[model samples]
Target: MTHFRNDMENHDFFDTNIVCSIVIYEWANELSIIDFKHIFDWISQLVGTAPDSIQLAESEAKYKSYKWKYFEKNNVINRREWDLIAYHWFRNIETKSGIRVYCVASTRSFRRLGIYIDEAAVVDVIGVMKQISRTIIEKVEPIYGYGAMQSYLDGPLEYARGINVTTYYSHENIFSQADVDTRERISAFGSEFRKNKRRLNEKLRDVEVINYISAGHLAGIVDGMTLEDWIISGNRGTLNKEGEATWVWRIPDEHERSQIRTDLIRSGLLVVTI
Candidate 1:
């Protein structure tokens, strides 16, 4: 069985030409939410422009709260510090160089900062990851961290023709305490996966791996992989002073992608039910 997303043509579908990088973090509850200014500012500098639109989530409580709406950039940026009490901020900022950047900041349990750029900008996703290590990980010391380049629409066709590159980053032992914490979480996830009665083969049925292959030619980078194999791949990982550790491969196409999706689901890092 294979899976396919029928809504790929929807408005919210990722733009094929857009390149995105995502940083995953265990929420920093101890840090002040106000630090969002510094984070967004860093993103603005990277894109070389102020944000055009902003969305905020101030109250955790759903009652009497409507802060998820998009607010004018000027209205939010021009306000005083005391007024910027939102727990989450999302921005859409673009540059004249034909680069589009989208940044999201949050102080919630699982914090993720996503950076989306136009392929034309040719921004270094790893550079962005290194900056995140210095500015966020060093100070906040998150329990676990991972960064990866995402697959966009038309990924199979684009990569089959040598259009884009796919990258993965998983950290181990960057900080003593955080390393231990991340290991424990991964272990627990592994245990949970084994306990599930659903067969691993069956789980693969829900997601389609879009690929293009010709006679005697396979354009996929990953041949065959299991859940544990993917989890243990992080053990050999190491980060530099700037906290850089990445695994890069070209032509991930649909086969490798399907394996990745399966790994993420089995590890509980992502969720989808058929």
Candidate 2:
């Protein structure tokens, strides 16, 4: 069995502890497409793991051929070689090493490449990201590129249920119980943030507000801090990855959670209505 890191430093968000170390990139075009072979090589060197199963686009179940060595035999499963030629894209990849990669094609109008790293190998997550970044053909601005530690909760916004807190921005990345139509969508490079600056300043006047876009590790954004460094700074229970996920996470003491929340708010990272 994989023994995940339990030390205080890793206690923040290691895999299967109900906590996940995740980095997501949403590209406007197909220019940022990742080279899966590069990723496989990196993971193999990083943690000695390789892809074992793949979930094709629109497929209901993951397909795995024990006869074929996914890593050695074929660097990556091209759509044409696979029996399912109708599916021309990769939806998700499940690796024996406990890391999962999600790639949504541009045909959906929203292309994204998301990597969920195992907590044990969380230290070099940015390395995995940098590997993907090497594929960028042109200097393209991302719709959203951020890393975050997500916890699997019982329900949407379960931590703040019943609280009359107002949410400023949300998207498919955030988990919320509010009606979908009521939630607001803010662009990464838009003037909406500037326009609402005064309102945010007044509401969180004394509080340091950290945007979700900088939640984890983003190249040119972390300010020389590594993913581990960011995780050590504070806890982020405000963000969640999956609601019905069966994974279990270690629930820190209330005082610890409160302190983390307070620290993040002070750093302008998290904002709550109390």
Candidate 3:
């Protein structure tokens, strides 16, 4: 692992231990159409909310229907108005006493950018996409750290695992396990397989080679291989025909360029450049 100095300025960070609720509102809008009933049913099962017990106020229902029709007629809504409403709702719940609430949704409608939801609530307004056939409650569980009280509306929101660069790899591991099981359990869950494959490919692309050695040895082996001032300048034929220079990367000849390249391949690192 590579370590870097901390260069962050002091700032107020949110409490990571607090219990938070997440609400994913799929409200009908001018941009995208979704199946409200299906989403409601899926969330209900996840949250342990009785399907029949969830209340849909009459006025809210009417407004939803009107907005649905309006969206159908017009391609999109007034962006400013929609943003204002979303902001107001988030502010209303975020400042509530005793508990922290987070608004998370895939849709860009929500104004809280890059804020991970402590809880997700799918409002009755947003309809579900038609292509979705099954709900994967387990996938959502690990996203919020496992053992969170899973619920649709009004369920106790459990804190999700803090998402950092290191945890990103962990998340991929969990997702890979889920994909393997999903392929065995459901015949049509090929989507999960494709998604995992794509992620694996992306991770392979980020692999890099780091060379650490004594400043003196690196200078003797190759120019510009060590710290700037420590580098030796001379006609050293350290580069290959492709103009790719070789650096003394602290590995013995047995683990040098050719051998290391092979090792990296086995370790799932695609060497795009020497």
Tell me the deviation in Å of residue 136 in model 3: 2.2
Better lDDT candidate (1, 3): 1
Each candidate: what lDDT? 0.36, 0.31, 0.24
Clashes of each: 2, 6, 21
Point to the candidate with the largest TM-score: 1
Off by over 4 Å in 1: 1-14, 27-29, 59-99, 109-111, 121-129, 154-274
Best model number under lDDT:
1
Instruction: Write candidate 3's Cα lDDT for 1-274 as tens digits.
Output: 1111122111212222222222222111222212333343344343333221111122212222123334335533332222211110121223422122222223232211111122222221112211111131211211111112222221232112111111112211331122332223222212332233322212121111222122222233212232223222322213211101212222223334345444344543321222
Q: How far in Å is the alpha carbon of 16 misplaced in model 2? A: 7.0
| TM-score quality measure for candidate 3 | 0.21
Worst lDDT 10-window in candidate 3: 138-147
Q: What lDDT score goes with residue 243 in model 1? A: 21
Q: List the candidate numbers ranked by TM-score, top first.
A: 1, 2, 3
Q: Estimate each model's TM-score.
A: 0.41, 0.35, 0.21
Q: Which is superior by lDDT, 1 or 2?
A: 1
Model 2, 1-274: lDDT tens digits are 2222223242332222232322222333444123433443343444333334443332313343332255246644453333210111111222232223322222122223344443344345445544433332123323333333433321112111112223422223454333432122112112332333323211221111111232221222123453235444544333322212111112235455445445444454322322
Which ten residues in a row are the worst by lDDT in model 2? 83-92
